[model samples]
Target chain A: MMESDINWNSIYEILTGPALWFTFIFFVGGLLIRLAFLFRLSRKKDRVIYNHFSLAWGLRSIFQWMIPWASASMRQQPVFSIVAFIFHLSLLAVPLFLSAHIVLWEEAFGVRLWSMPDGLSDGLTLIFIAAALFLIARRRIRPEVRILTSAWDYALLGITMLPFITGFLAYHQWGPYEVLLILHILFSQILLILIPTTKLGHMVLFFLTRAFIGFEMGGRRGARSW
Target chain B: MTSPTKKKFEFENNTDAPVDVDRVRAILNANDGARIRTWLSICSRCGLCAESCFVYVANDRDPRLSPAYKFSHTLGEMYRRKGKVDRAFLEKCYQIAWLQCTMCKRCSMYCPFGIDVATMIAVARSVCHSQGITPKQLAFFSDHCDKTGNHMGIPVEELVDTCEWMVEEVEDDYEGVTIPIDQPDAKYMYTVNPREPVYYPQDISYAAIIFAAAKESWTMPTFGWDCTNLPMFAGNRTLAGKQVKNVYDKAQELKAQHILITECGHAYRSMAFEGPYMAGYPDGKPPVKIKHYVQLLHEYLRDGRIQIDSDKKIKEPITYQDPCNVSRNGGLWEQARKIIPYIAEDFRDMAPNREHNHCCGGGGGIMPMGPDYKPYRMASGKLKADQIKATGAKFVITPCHNCFDQINDLSEEYDLGVKALSFKEIIVEAMIVPDHLKLECEK
Candidate 1:
């Protein structure tokens, strides 16, 4: 038992130290490089977009979409819209403000943002897990979504959900707690690496694309795209 | 409304011509720019775009017909394969790009990422175009536009003769009405779809009468009078640019303040919006200002250039079919809405009107795709038919010829007993002529 505990501790330390830092650098640096490359390419080949880039229109388009049910499209598919909002909000919030994650941030960088209370964090994590399951079920059962889904899409969903699952299990002290804690850290790092590299890159690319469409539809033509 | 007889196109399939794989690669490489690259990279396949597509809904929500699948299986596959795709693959891509989707851009609005699947479909069509695999009817019109300045191959003599003929028809209603041609320093250099001269010359007479009532100076360019760019719909960017440049040059030569486009949606979009980009203008704008007919009519009503007879206004329930290009892409939605109250007493809007309205299923040159696609076109138009039916409107006013024809066809096919009228038709029917411009017999 002592030896097993020591092994888990070393693994946890490694995941929380160099692995976490490496993942952070890769996530930020890689996305920045990719974004810069794409932005430059856009200016070079599609300079028409730049000639009519209106900040007011772009922000209006983005802002309208950010609000729940602000768009006709959102209203058309209310169930999916609500679930997506919840999923994305929880996805961003849990990682940034969960009390446990805040502890890591304070220890590593001597900085911390406001943290969610333990009860609220627990509630949000359950909602996140439910939303993830709903998304998976949607892909599995919804014919339109299923047809668009490939093995890679399902795998990405699994990768995204595993860290949260493992973390929840660890917090509840269910099963091998140390192993679950180490897996939660490792799975999260893996997700960070995959985000800037795979379809998960949409997390950042969505803003650019939304802004481009806004500029094209609204700025150039004076139509509200959202 | 008479349908133009389907012409037998020479290069319908062009199967004998060897598939130009190298040309396909070149075109794909050129079109795979930053916008397309980012769009392809970011599509999460959420399938939220599925429900927004009228075609998918009309076809009973088939997953295969979903916009996400349409773009992904075509352009996404080509990009994944690095444009080394074969003729059979190109044939499949052509089916999905041309037959399955209308590139109406409705899907883009629903996308959380704002993925312009229509743009991807257009790029897919362009790739197919390189391999000589375009819809034959569209290809025929495109070739005509490339060779002659008009899609129907109407020569300058025919257009001038049509203008003269339309002037005679209009003079019966308004004594001094004339369809002016190449009148220099005209405030508006007007343009029309080639179909106006070919099948619906009455459209010309209505415009002439409207201008006479408004006391506005407008002239049609005899050289580049055809404003519609069917070549752009065929994915022939070179021909599209050339066609737009023809109109632009004519407007510039005439020194017109605004190049007023007739009541055509795609023509307005091509001339005002996409054409300049395709023509590679530095500012991405036409040399002269481009105006749609809706905007002009709205201005005419607002400025009291023409008076509407309140008693002559149609009292039947009316609904408007918002052309995707004109309303959504061209930013003229409110202009049409403003015009409605002037001409109709009872106007009922469709459930999802304005920019969110479904395509009448004839956009992107689908109306010209000919008899081969009629059954599918009618089927896909089911969503629009239902939208119109729900409003229970007797008259459907759409300013676009494409929508006019499709809605008329839908009315007939669905037995909805509705009349599809262009705004020009409605306005001409209801507007009162000034006594000074009235004919002797009428006065």
Candidate 2:
């Protein structure tokens, strides 16, 4: 090989090797997971046509209908609602588009979507970590919601943010390199498995329910879709 | 009256009391797990509902008084311990679920999230029903209703005798009006709360006067004649089911098209909703059609079946108290308001009216339970008094038995100098004469 063959990029080694193995496991594991989800769904009773369509649309609609900063409706104060709301929205925006997720996606399927720039990713990551921390603090603090909440629920939430935090650290190459990377992968794997099991399943289903509820209200009920 | 054979009139000790802890545990465990989503999923905990609740407003806004919290106290514990909760814990659950709250849906209307507090209470009551741990007061009245076939415990013979007496009284006054029972092929089967046959038998005459003026084919069945379903308040679904089933059986036996429940809150709720669901669509057949008497009369007046001779000649201003069960739960608040002016001339509007109107503190078997529940009753009824005072009405016209009981108590206890009047009482004052219409000739 010529001197030019010595590609000085450590990223080359990551892209060609370790990232590849991590991603192959993710794909096979993710497919197995989604297959189990399909099996579970198949056993449930048939959904009405509206449900099917709304749910399909609702799956992709978290960012589709962006409102101008969620103005407060007369009967509903969407302010506190917006707090948990942003915490969720940040979860979608930050981790799903982090540089690591892009790398994993490319390795898994040889497909690529735009990843956020490093500065934007870090800024959003910090904001998201802060928002999630705020939510955890609320569940620990607010008496009413606190009564309904359990420590297991808080632990589950804490476990969920671990992957994002660690992956962000991995991207920054902060702290012990191998340990943070392993923690990131382990937490991400746990989140992927736990997604459909808990009330956190509402994280996926609430969109569909909310959208359908909105459409039902707007189309037939004549109430404004909030 | 078939002489009201003594065999037909004895009260059974349905208590099965000295309750079996094991059986009670199994039933509680089963019911607590059955309707999980109805209790847990429906509540979104937006505190807007706090303002409309009688218990919350009356109890210094302790979160416990919030109907939502009452549910959490009971159902939450049942969930926490995974339904292996103790009988002692359940006894308290029974008290709060049955006594502390009136199963009113006023809060549901205010709930921006549409968390139905009444549905929660009803489900909680369904649990209590399984436990046989209902309030002693509700239990007593329900036992009396089940055994004697009427909450007032009027013997079957005495009930028939009173009906016959009303027939005689109506004849002497209107000339040829007949109050027939078990009349085959009648279009409507009318029932009143046992309140009439026992004490205010005059109200029966008022009803008779209305029916006769309209010349409708109606009947009252003496076999299973009472209409008010008491087991509903007691949270005794078995008895409620039997009572409602008996109504359908009697109606079917008489070949009646529709049976009308009296102006009793629990009665209408049980017969109109619970009964149908309990014995609904047997073998996929259509459920029996039942209507509340208030709504039935509202339609009667609305469609010109009955005409008022005068806006009841009373001079005092009257404010209407909407029974929470009837107005909010039954969706008949407007219909109730529509019928009031037909019976009584002077009706002044009250504040926080319609579906938002306060409970009259008598429902959930509170009144018949007597005074043990009076403290909770007085505490919860302050909003009602405030609304009444705002109306400055001399009389409060409520078209429900429980509301009537509560309103009477509040009026006397508060010394508001206001009289509590039922629609029957007010309509009796305003009903036109059949003799004047030349409609009767039996004398």
Residues B1-443 of candidate 2 have per-residue lDDT tens digits of: 01112221111223434545455456455443212332354344434455567777766665556666677778666666555655566666766775677777565444433344564565556555565566666677788877877777778678778888988876656755677878988988887788777768887877777677778788877865677776776667678777777777888888889887766777766676556545543332215577777777788789877666774466778888888667665667778888876765677988667755678766766566666567667777776877787788898887787787777778777777788787765665676654543434532
For residues B257-316, write the lDDT of model 1, one tens digit per residue: 989899998999899888898877878878989989999999999999888999999999
Two-chain DockQ for each candidate model: 0.71, 0.10
- Interface RMSD values for the candidates, listed in order? 1.2, 7.5
Q: C-alpha displacement of B178 in model 2, angstroms?
A: 2.6
Error of 1 at B10 (Å): 9.5
Pairs of residues clashing in candidate 1: none
Q: What is the lDDT of candidate 1?
A: 0.86
TM-score of each: 0.96, 0.73
The backbone clash count of each candidate, in order, is 0, 0
The recovered share of true contacts, given per candidate in order, is 0.67, 0.00
